[model samples]
Target chain A: MHLYRYEENPLITPNDVPPHHDGFEVIGAFNAGVAKFQGEVLLLLRVAERPMSDDPNIVKAPVWNPETGKVDVYEFRKDDPRYDFSDPRVIKEAGAERFLYLTSLSYLRLARSQDGRRFTIDDRPFVYPSNELETFGIEDPRITYIDGTYYIYFSAVSPKGVGEAMVSTTDFRTVTHHGMIFAPENKDVLIFPEKINGKYYALHRPVPRSNGRPEVWIAESENLLHWGNHRFLFGLREGKWDSARIGGGAVPIKTEHGWLELYHGASDDHRYCMGAVLLDLNDPAKVIARSERPLVEPEADYEVNGFFGRVVFSCGALVDGDVVKMYYGAADTSMACVELKLDEILDSLVKV
Target chain B: MHLYRYEENPLITPNDVPPHHDGFEVIGAFNAGVAKFQGEVLLLLRVAERPMSDDPNIVKAPVWNPETGKVDVYEFRKDDPRYDFSDPRVIKEAGAERFLYLTSLSYLRLARSQDGRRFTIDDRPFVYPSNELETFGIEDPRITYIDGTYYIYFSAVSPKGVGEAMVSTTDFRTVTHHGMIFAPENKDVLIFPEKINGKYYALHRPVPRSNGRPEVWIAESENLLHWGNHRFLFGLREGKWDSARIGGGAVPIKTEHGWLELYHGASDDHRYCMGAVLLDLNDPAKVIARSERPLVEPEADYEVNGFFGRVVFSCGALVDGDVVKMYYGAADTSMACVELKLDEILDSLVKV
Candidate 1:
């Protein structure tokens, strides 16, 4: 497959924003929602703030000490079996629930661009984890345009697990949080471009049962809040390069081929890459064709080494004509963008 | 995952068969049709045969010499880029369908035992590749017993691609081939034990598009010959250990929980292992539950190093009371057996 890399790759870096805590860094800076608002390219970025220490020699690490109502340092060991400091996303004991210490806390940051190249980011986080379940973070924001309203779907992670939540804004400053549309342990919630057969269609990743692999499911609703007709769409690849896990990335784009979607794939090693699949426009659950090779991989220094290594995660992309401008998180530390001609990518896909 | 190896490990070895053909190894041997016939356990094994040569200079090894009408041999190097002999089942070009050299030739072989322990194997091959498309070999046979008749489903391979074929035998001696049931570029065909909702169901692995990952698809039939209603059942796990490829191993067994089935998984490294899944009894296509960890893996020397290493393949298993006797091929060379208490195995599965 012919691949294109940005000249100024690793466009976003770890130093872009300082961490809120001492032991973590700010990561997962992505465009949660994007649209032409007020005659400008507006982007809602999910900037994740995590603990900042990478050294194991420093036994004590800073954490949000709930009991003390302040950030406190706790002592752990380099060889501690209970804590897996090696993993950037999760840390846990053998029997305990996996906890994420560092995540892109749901703060809807703003960015503006004229040529869609250089973006000027807002100084403050736009949105924060308001609810108890969202104490951990909010992540992977997908923007869907319905009528004149812009709906933002993001992942809300907490002790309860990750769930899909939506918030809408007509004017950037005045936003209306729409509560959780789907249950917990759900993410990658992408709203279909338009209503299907007079019903709102959305693609969601729900971990229906604990300890089981997560799969893509579809739900329909008369209104956006109450969803029904829950049907399983896709599951993890059993014994292939993608056998590890998968998640919804950018919002589904409607094209002549179908609902084109760019998705992220992780192997057991947690190396993240991006691929695409075409879903039947009428029936979003029906997969038309999918790409055999990943559209984007972790090849740059920022992508291969950071808060997390070998990760190329995207939660939003903007389609202009036949080209798709994708903004992604590299190594969970910085943001980057790559452009692909939609027709060329679709043409490279293998059809069954 | 807690794994238990058979006490009498490596219960079957390559030396069990005659060694005249310079390692006429028994590989891809599956339980095709097992029955309590004439006071003995009759098993149809799909034994894969290949000549063994120690030479490493000549890269292109001939499997069958058409001019001489005999099996031919050649040499292959581990460092050769044009041909990769790394994969045991398939050794294809870097990104092409052309294979390096034929390393295995599959044919059906018969074995019988009065006590399900000590067995007697027939010296002659029962089924061999007949057409040009099936010149490579046949492998992974699944048998279904319906109305006092035995029907066998197996993979037929050639330069064209791997496809599923059917054959029937009532008394072992008189066999009738049913030609190809599925088109080329497919394998792991398994027929449901009985009709569901007045229609026959079968599970097949199809690579409908080249270079794309394989997926499980379901088909329905009225006469068990012409199948329709072909629909997607499941895809491989993305970013997991078994995220690469998956295929049906043994025939589905009827249970109160659902249609219990043992399936095989391969990682990107091509290590094959066994797992179980439950499908809705009434709707055989709906997956009810699946095992998170593999029930069996290649650990022993015979299982880790032989004609192919790190492989444990199965096509047949017999349930007696609450015990399931799994007959599997180890390291693509010998037949081995493992006894699993049905309820214990079910306990390990993730219920959905």
Candidate 2:
């Protein structure tokens, strides 16, 4: 409830990204994962690209074909009812069996800042789909710096499903893929900076195929290749705002109290908001305290309008002693920054 | 159109299957893939089962959990508008974004037939999902016997997407899993038994993420594990019975004229029918001819009145001299058999 928004908010938008081609335009530049690397603040910006078409009846989407080893295009006639273009960010196949696809192709683009306020974006894409498993494109990257290495875990999108894939960089310039860490039916994975109890721990959100609700889960790995010991961490609180789904945010920060985790939750209406949860320092499976209400909601006009309206989702955050600097995507379109006192958030928390 | 339907149709139903437990009931015993092995005809019947509850407002689906090595059940209340129980067989999530789930769990069951009409179905299941790739269940299996080995290719469903997986059985008792042969966003696979031009080829259907259209594709594999060289085979014929989607039916028969293949097609209105296509013997990718009209359609009451009405899908067929014995699932609920002169089908197919 006590947060200060930056004066020059909406730091990055479509105008910041360089054009890929003549017919394609950058539609969105938001949902960035933040980190402090090489004495500079880095934001892994999600850049969305869509084809510019003159025909009012047609909409085009970019496609990556691994079979042909080329990038192709899809043109959909607006006159045909097969497509649901209600949300500007994504297009849904309007049929008995639904297939929701993002209208524009999204890939990770790097933006760096000296003061963590103004950023200079790179012209080339940082991460894109290079294989069939990533045909849709890579998105929502969460950077975890552990043991002198920066590990980026991102959501690999394809027609198959969304899953978490890992890539590591020692110097931010040389990136190396570590293969798909988890298969389909997984997302919103955030790894801790160091191992807990001699085992690497990560917070994940697994969508249950059964009747169980979707919630945040914690898993441990000895080698980081084979993960097991999954336990539910945070769940939906019935008859509440964050009662539908909860996901892990950036890397968890260890404090004297416990491991502090800033998470995102959504209601049944799909309105996303930011919340906080505290886990036991030794056992993250044991949730200590949780926020009773949302920390950040869609209140500003920039957060109220654009691509997908009424959504304030955070991918990463930095805790500098008392001040919690958070970078969140506004309305699923643009990015903004906010800072809140750590005591104010902990005071707002309720014992769970 | 000269095919003769057997008088004793709908040979197997849910009532014929032995109960797995007292509380549960078999919902469907249909879509059997046919094969002749060890001097007897075999039917790989898809038996679907669901848990029964005293409460009329709830529906339950059984899930095999590999983690716990137990069958977990998902119970959904009818009052929850989030669940759509429109189609009796499948329960759909009815939000703006939708996903269809089978109300009952399905697995392949073996039914032995000495006379090819009356069958003694085995009490135990033949094949079900055992890994994460097949979390949903395997469906619509096609058996191709090559070099004294029976290969079973089936549709593997999960939350990720639908794809094809392969297995082999030397004695139909000990089956060997070959892992997932194809990735997600694909199905309707038919593998040719022997190698053509020193390569094992298969007919596949890859649903394009783009707007290109859904059509049958051909791929070649050197070791049957790594497949490549994909080529488009047959596509939909607009404004006709087979105007929407077409998939491979059985293994292509080696005829004197060429390789004759019987396939299944569906119209936009979900009207499923059967058709035939001829490919060059040396080059299976080259289509020599195609059926101008449907070979078998849902015209009878048995075909139009069961689960998933107005559907007739084939999984396997056999060729003995000039006669073709074909087994198909009607309305996705019950199986039936028909016989046709092979020459008659070839004559019906016109050069395209």
Candidate 3:
């Protein structure tokens, strides 16, 4: 498949987004949800920030303490046998059953582009962590515009476990927060732009504990608050690019062929790539077809080397005419954009 | 405080309940939910059965296959490096992120008793694995008699994850399944017998992936199917008898002073015991008091040795006057009974 990468790729970096506090530094500004409003393209970016430590033996972790209602930093000695810092992204307690703490905290920030490439970032965060469920932080925002409202769905992370939560805003100035719509150990939730068969439908990835890999599951809701009628939509393919795990990406675009869904999948080696799946337009649960190979791989230098390497994850995309404008997070560090033809993606999908 | 153990301590054992099939053996007949129905005491017992293999090198795991709609046995070599069988209850995959499969499949069976001590076991399962969510099995039932219906809440285990599911019955003949009431990584959900302030309340333990330990959480529901208004009720007290992890046990018994709740807590050494928690009668979320020491410890031989040793877990109890007839699972192997005085138990709680 032929794809076009913008000349000035890596559209937004950590340096472009300011830290939330005085002692913190922005580590990542990526994994944005793309949307169009008021004749401008908007990217809701996930900005990750971490507290700085001067001592070589000490590492700091920021946590939202619900009791004191403030963000607190926990300092751990690198020499301590109890604290396992093997994973750069998290600080795990070394024991039989693991307890995890993020190395950095993440929240959503807004960026706008008139030309769909160059952009101006908002001074303040679009959405920040507030509740106990968001004690660790929030990550990965997906925007779905329906009627006159823009519904923003993101992953709420805490010691409680990662779950999906929603918020809504029309002008992007004020926000109305909706409490957690999904329980813990779940993320990558994307809502359909329009109701299907008179009910609101959503795609979610629930990470299993005992068995099963993370796969996309569909559920329908009445008021968009309480969700039910859960059915497993699809799972990982054997000996394929997405053999490890898979999740729902960009709000599925409606087409004559089917509901075109751009999704992210990982290999056994943790290499992330974007793939496509075609679901029946009327019945979103029915899978019509899916990609045999990745539509976008982590081949670019920006995508191959960053905070977390070998990843190209997209949460949102915008379709104009036959051109699909895809915004993805490169290596969990910086934001980048690419363009793919609608017909080319559709043709690439192997029939089930 | 003084307590009395029933003369026939283990009222039901694996020898009393027949295996589900030819090659299968009833490994466990415990963790039963006690209820007073008609003129007899009913025990909804979690009967665990596993396929027996004569080959000393092979371990068999029973799994409910969604595709075949049947229970299938998976055999793994004891010498296989990919499979880790160190944990007696579950088989874990050996590398990176682990996948788990149960050594035995569990389903609920019914046992009827004229007196609260001696019982007769049912021939068929009261409730068995039916859907994909319960592929692993259904376990640890907590029955609450509300109005005329008995609400049987259980932990539905699958590769998807362990979550709480509900089933209701007026007569023991048939049941109405209420899908999953709580999502994955959560279990030990106990619903109150009746509504308080026009809404139903339940206590649950959601095992966290990241930070928090498994603690008791209270949630209120309008329909009992969808829960909301979640609040952290209580957690483990450091250096106490109940320190490692805690979960709701028998349904809360409403009393004149408050609501008396029996909860199971595990120590750092994995010794399980039962403790008491007192909550506000009107608002169950409000903590009134809790036990500084355990009410029931694994001191008996049956409770100290079996499938899982040093465990005493209760799901249901019958409150007759000032006597609390508690039926508990001893070491995950047999059903046992004990009686505690309500006044003595209530006085043992240390005021919070």
Task: Supply fnat for every model shown.
Answer: 0.00, 0.00, 0.24
DockQ values of all predictions: 0.02, 0.05, 0.31
| Tens digits of lDDT, candidate 1, A1-352 | 5556677766555466655544556665654466667767766776766554567453443333335544444556657776666544555543444453432343557777776656777776666566644656667677888888888778766544455677887777767886666644457778887897787877776543212345566666665754544455666775544567787788888889888988888888888899888888788878878767788888888789876788888877888898888878788667788888899888977774
Best by lDDT: 3
Tens digits of per-residue lDDT, candidate 1, B100-164, equal 44666767767788767666877776666655445666676777888877887787665444556
lDDT of 1 at B195: 91
Number of colliding residue pairs in model 3: 1
Q: State in Å the error of residue A165, model 1.
A: 36
Which scores better on TM-score, 2 or 3? Answer: 3
Instruction: Order the numbered candidates by TM-score, best leading.
Output: 3, 2, 1
Q: Kindly list the per-residue Cα lDDT of model 3 for residues B1-352, writing each as its tens digit.
A: 8879888988898999999866899989999999998999999999999899899899888998878867899999999999888878888888634557899999999999998888999999989888888999999999998889988989888877777888999998899987777766678899998899998889988765545667888777666766655556888888987898899999999999999999999999999999999999999989999999999999999999999999999998999999999999999999999999999999999999
Error of 2 at A40 (Å): 5.1
* Docking quality band of candidate 1, CAPRI definitions: incorrect
Grade the docking of candidate 3: acceptable
Off by over 4 Å in 3: A53-58, A67-70, A77-82, A94-99, A197-199, A229-231, B55-57, B66-69, B79-82, B94-99, B196-198, B228-231, B256-258, B281-283
* Model 2: per-residue Cα lDDT over A11-102, one tens digit each: 88787787664578887788888889888999998887787888988877677788885567887887778778765665678863334566
What residue pairs are clashing in model 2?
none
Candidate with top TM-score is 3
Question: Residue-wise lDDT of candidate 3 within A27-93, one digit each (tens)?
Answer: 9999998889999999999999999888989888999787886789999999899888877788888
Question: Candidate 2 vs candidate 3: which has greater DockQ?
Answer: 3
